[model samples]
Target: MAGKRVAGGGGREEDGSKVGLPAMDLALAFPQATPASIFPHSVSDYYQFDDLLTTEERSIRKKVRSIMEKEIAPIMAEYWEKAEFPFNAIPKLASLGVAGGTIKGYGCPGLSITASAITMAEIARVDASCSTFILVHSSLAMVTIALCGSEAQKQNCLPSLSQLCTVGCWALTEPNYGSDASSLRTTATKVPGGWHIDGQKRWIGNSTFADVLVVLARNADTKQLNGFIVRKGAPGLKATKIENKIGLRMVQNGDIVFNKVFVPEEDRLPGVNSFQDISKVLAISRIMVAWQPIGISMGVFDMCHRYLKERKQFGVPLAAFQLNQEKLVRMLGNIQSMLLVGWRLCKLYESGKMTPGHASLGKAWTSRTAREVVSLGRELLGGNGILADFLVAKAFCDLEPIYSYEGTYDINSLVTGREITGVASFKPAALARARL
Candidate 1:
């Protein structure tokens, strides 16, 4: 191919180089020279993660992102500042048709795991509390019923739950049974036609206003774990709101007390007969949490990206600095790996080969990586990172609760360890009684 003459003077090639204008200006075309507004926001799928999602999945992600950016992003800081839940967003959120994303019946949309995971990440990328609210209702509470409830129970409960007319909370954590769920101290005694439960649940999301609570209790007679649907304001069910939380402040974490809360046999989940059964719900939920941090990190990444372009130091964009760019790339790399892990986990779930170990590993690894990315993001933002208005600081704090929930960093590692080595590491602690 021959070079073409420039319109005014020197010949030009297909590369669009102005022949007369020396290539010296190339240095001026640093990253942000492209202009700030053109930069895509809240998006960090660097490794073509979108290519893995189906068209509908992409649509769901886009729709959820749009809603987050448009509605939730504006007032979220105030909600987080006030430590209040956005009660008004329920109908709009419900209308998204993602409540029973993986479940195929009872008004559930039954989207693929990839779609659901993307939705969670998108929502979390803006507001973690909102994402937690949805995940608690969708993946945790709804899945418990969809996967474990009787057909009658499913028919009666899931429709409204999907519609967002009713909110749900999964109650497994207690003041003492945070990690040792297998040894839940909650008791369920069989009555003539119902069961009576007496236990306290700690850090219960959506509990204060949850229309239904999915509580796991040990059978008084069999000693096996069983699931119950405790309705809101049930005579004996008291959901005391927990306050002064440093992280996830908008999540409405509550200390729920089950004082002789009676759940009829019809309200019981027939399939949840053991702690192992709850693990099935957790196996996927853990993966969803892994997806969540990617969004949280992505949100911070977007903030940092925008901050670097807009904020100038030493007469140039902060992002124009080598160290700043390197940090940004590192954050991107961590987020990309996090997304890849979550995507592969979803693929495994779709293929019926997703083990609890897979979910635990992804959750643990991604949460750990995401925490670093967010921390770096706070560093990049300098003073702005500490402000809730910026969201980076909020996510940094919110990560603390998530880093520990589902399974702690160490506990999840232990879970993965057990799967790999075929051995249980959890042994009873030896008492240190003194011989007086």
Candidate 2:
């Protein structure tokens, strides 16, 4: 009996129509050592750096990795392409209960410094924008209050922020002053019950929609820098989103305008009195920034390794070539070295023995190495590397902001050099007179 033919794809014939040819073996016949799988599973951790982590630390990494893979990985590329923030994912992220990182109490997670550092690395392993968003919220904004806010302020703010009920941003850099944060232009005039903040902040993360903003303004009376908590919908406070950024596009960086914004005395952070006080925050954050590149570099390496294994040219797999293998090896070496440095930096932080200069050195060295690693990854990918869909292009561009921020490469190096040498290089070059 003749079978009726379907009008679509299938090996069938009806009436006098010819049957479709037998299915051909179209799969590639390349020699392989192991079955191919989509990344993460096949990623090479050449040095077994996970062995150094504690059980809690590894658990945190695994949990965060799962979150990033399930939630962030699906949508990050789209958000990056649109240059928009993912407002919807905040709840799921907050559910992870890592907002406090190393901070104790006030509904905070109270995790160890190393564990917190591991979380940041895990986040960066997927997307730098998401990790930087956390860096701004947890490392900078929440930690500012944890370290310097009054008890009443902490009781009021910390719980909501810890739960992600309220997103916060730390405002310190201004349009005219980035590296020289001490020379800020923002002014806080003393008023009847509080302060009238009149100035602006630039490059503020989470500023556009954050419920709370921690602003740094110089006191008009004492001429000292101070931190003030300003709520959203303040009469004269406006946060305009910065546009056309090439890196970290998913983060909502803003130019915040303060037009006589009044903050109650209770909102003022009493503990932040000087640049020295602010340095406390920077010291820890710089260490975290040092870890960011390590994760980002590992991500780049993972992508390259997978591409090399699957992509073929001249009827040979890319991974089979010697030059391509060297590139991956170099990237892995950079990742391992960066991982060790960041781990040691965390130990120093845990011991309370980490100096700002030591942190500056780590941040400087690791970010520099990551640049090389990402550049090599882009090369290994050839033409496909430029597309955000492949991951390396976005990561390569994202590394720029990370490199320049925290501190410029030369600036961090000079900071380390200043600590090693007794002389300050930033001071005016009076060596011309010393020659006499």
Candidate 3:
């Protein structure tokens, strides 16, 4: 028998509806090279950076690498395309056992700072967004509590956060103040039982779904920075996800609003009476952030290395061209240098010799260097460079946000400049009051 007439699509006509086309598989569309779904093997460690890590550090690296490639890589591009987090992957991430990085107790792993930093690198190597999610939770939020929270607060929050049973986010930057975070206008007014926090925070990673939020505000009485542990679902607390981001798409960065959100006295962080108090936490966080770019560079280089070998031009492999080989070598050199600088920053922190300048310099330089690495990798991929399925394009976009956050490249450079020059250049000459 003849088939029934179709409306606009296949099969029988029904309501003149169109049938949706099936999604094209990247592999089938581009058969010349494999995408990041089947992640490439790591071949960027040319300088034997592994030897520099301790036994435990190496073990953690291996564990994290395996899970990230096997679990995260397969789903990263999909989620990145959708601009949504893979909520289902939490269990796999928690299994890595590196959360609450550098914290010693309360169900924490108590990893050496080196191990902690290496762990961050390994995570970023596979997906910068996943690494950032963990960084905001562990390095930024959990560390703030560990460094500044009262003993009771620690007892209450750390155990759950360490296991990823509860996620955490730290809120410091406000809508008006990012680089000038110390001048933030969020206010904390003393109330009958505790404090009433009123402010708006922007670009806060994990805030959209964090179980606990560490919010920084100006004390109405003291006029200095103070912090509070604001629970999720608190009255007058709202976190809306920021959308249309070009980078770190898996991370749900949020714009948070607090309208008289009441935090009990016990939830107030006593250590954060002033901005300097949080500066300590920031210095350490900066080191961790520095390692992220290093890891990202590693991933990009690895992706490019595999792509060059698999893809061909004019009947020869891309890797056979002298220019492509030069680009690959340049990327490798950047990664090696970045690795060393990041490692040294950790050591300096461990020895208590690291100053703000040292941390800022490390962060600024490594991120800038990684910028070049990702760019080169992007160039090597040519048309495929713009496709997220191939990994280099995503890394190219991802590196831009990393270059700006945790203090922008210019801000960090000035930080180091001030340390060496003994002159603060953060603000331009003040216009000499216009000489009225």
Among these predictions, the greatest TM-score belongs to 3
* TM-score, structure 2 vs. true: 0.89
**TM-score for each candidate, following the candidate numbering:** 0.88, 0.89, 0.95
Query: For residues 11-122, what per-residue lDDT tens digits would candidate 1 score against the true structure?
Result: 5655676555554432253433222112238657778888877899999988988777777787787788899998887776876678887889788988988899989998
Clashes of each: 0, 0, 0
Poorly placed runs, candidate 1 (over 4 Å): 1-40, 428-436
Give the winner by lDDT: 2 or 3: 3
lDDT of each: 0.85, 0.86, 0.94
| Candidate 3 residue-wise lDDT, 284-315, digit = tens | 89999999999999999999999999999899
Best by lDDT: 3
**Model 3 compared with the native: what TM-score?**
0.95
Error of 3 at 315 (Å): 1.6
| Superior candidate under TM-score, 1 versus 2 | 2
Compared with the true structure, the alpha-carbon lDDT of candidate 3 equals 0.94
Clashing pairs in 2: none
